[model samples]
Target: MTTDSSDLSQVDEEAKLDLTQQIRDAILGGEFAPHQRLIEADISARFDATRAAVRTALLNLTGEGLVERLPNRGARVRAISVDEAVEIVEVRIGLESLCARKAAVNITDADIEELRGVRAQIEAAVASGHLVEYARLNQEMDRRIRDIGGHETATRLLERLRAQSARHQFRLAFHPGRASQSAPEHIAIIDAVLARDPDAAEAATRAHLEGIVDVLRHLD
Candidate 1:
């Protein structure tokens, strides 16, 4: 039964979403590194799809600013400049502050529990020095907060910025002692959210974002 379902999905390309997702997964999985040029032919060959499909996928990634399309150079993974990094950090602060504030009013007990589960896992990952797990859990926490906040516009804006900001953030965040510093900030934000204090949640979340900014200053 599982084989049949998987077989049926093989030819499903009506939406083009699967193709886009595969490309994104490839990028996120570290198959492609920052500033690595994407050869359309190679990608098409890998996916067993047409050049058109590959081009479409590239265009979508470009639109999201995750891939840069240069006139002569073609597409490469986007790289963030220090200036861009600062801007992204600023935008993240505002978006997450909004998320924390809105979440105070709308968060359910189940949502709170889900956040706690994510937080616990993040803490464990930090303790074990598991950078990959830590990054994933960090993203999950951000996503949960955005979802619970009920601020669609702010969430969408943050999502777009994050797509481009990831390389810089990943570099800035996983520094030797940085994960340990970050874990408690997550706890503080969650504490404020659990208390249903919008002001406290907003402040706590902003403080957390600023903490990252401070660490980023020390990056090589």
Candidate 2:
């Protein structure tokens, strides 16, 4: 008996999401290096998925800025140009600083405690050398901080930039001592926010992004 078209469509969508996540994790985990070509046939073979499913996954990744597809060159992990990298940092500096400033004004005691809890988890991840977990916690902390601003527009923009930012952060987190150094920086921001000091919170956010920009500048 033939399956319904809707059932077939649902299965296809699930396959695409699964493969997209796998490819995204691989790229973010450095298995798929920046600018590394992604051959459809190879990916299809490795994942035991249909070429169509692989194509859809690649397209989804491309939308997320994790994959790039060129006319004749096919797909590859998206490589940020120096200019693009600098621009991303500049955008982050603006958005995050604004979020911190607003968070300082609107954040409640509960917010501070929740943020502190996440910060503690991040510290634990750092101490244990769980680099991946640290990155995930760090991202969560940033999201929570942004949510304190209560500005949907700013938060949405930051969220889009964050996906691109993750690629850089994943690479940066791997460098010796990077995660350790970043932990205290986050503490400073948390402290400023907890104190409801808008200026200090904004400055702390800017300083953190500046440090990231410096690191990106030195990368090959």
Candidate 3:
């Protein structure tokens, strides 16, 4: 029995995509530090993929702005500077505020309950000094708002921007007193959406992200 060439091609593409996502997750999860070199052989061995596959995966991540390729230096996780992080958050402020408005108009009873649960968890995490958990739940809340808003284009753009800005965000998450400051902002967003107040939701979302830009500007 002969395997079809098209079938083999599809399998290869799937494997490459899987490998790319694994490396992307590692970078986003902080397993790979910003600007750290990604050696092809080491990555190949670590991920149990071929050098060629690792190379392709790195290229894909580079396109996604999660990795960078240098002349004669291979690739490394891209480092987003404070200025760039602020710019990214500025862009997010517009997009996320739009999402908040749309989500306020589009949210249902079930979505409201779901977001309330996440908000409660975030409050609990903050009250207990679990900053990491609070950070993660904050992301969860953003994702839920996007889903509820149902803006595919905005969601796609935000996903890429979020990945590119992950390291800076991770730093902000652990900054002194950041969680305490941000928890109320996040809760305000949720409250506005649950209240179905589109104007207030948009205002709350903009305030939340604008605060991040302020902090990014002041980051040492």
Q: Which candidate is the best by TM-score?
A: 3
TM-score of each: 0.87, 0.77, 0.94
lDDT of 3 by residue, 1-220 (tens): 9999999999999999999999999998889988899999999999999988898999999989999999999999888889998999999998999999999999999998999999899999999998888888988999999999999999999999998998899899999988889999999999999999999999999998999999999999
Q: Sort by TM-score, best first.
A: 3, 1, 2
Across 1-220, the per-residue lDDT of candidate 2 in tens digits comes to 9899999989888878999889887877778888899999999999899899999999988987878899999999988776687788888899899999999999998998899899789889988999989888888888888899787888877766766666767778787788878888998998899899999999999999999888888877
Q: For residue 145, what is the lDDT in candidate 1?
A: 83
Model 1 lDDT-worst window of ten: 6-15
Candidate number with the higher TM-score (1 or 3)? 3
- Candidate no. 3 TM-score: 0.94
Give the distance in Å from residue 192's predicted Cα in candidate 1 to where it truly belongs.
0.9
lDDT of 1 by residue, 1-220 (tens): 2567665556555536678878887876678987999998999898888888888889988888878898988899886776777778888898899899999889998988988898788889988989888888888888888899989999888987887777777785668877888888888888888888999999999998888777777677
| Candidate 1 Cα RMSD (Å) | 4.2
lDDT of each: 0.83, 0.86, 0.93
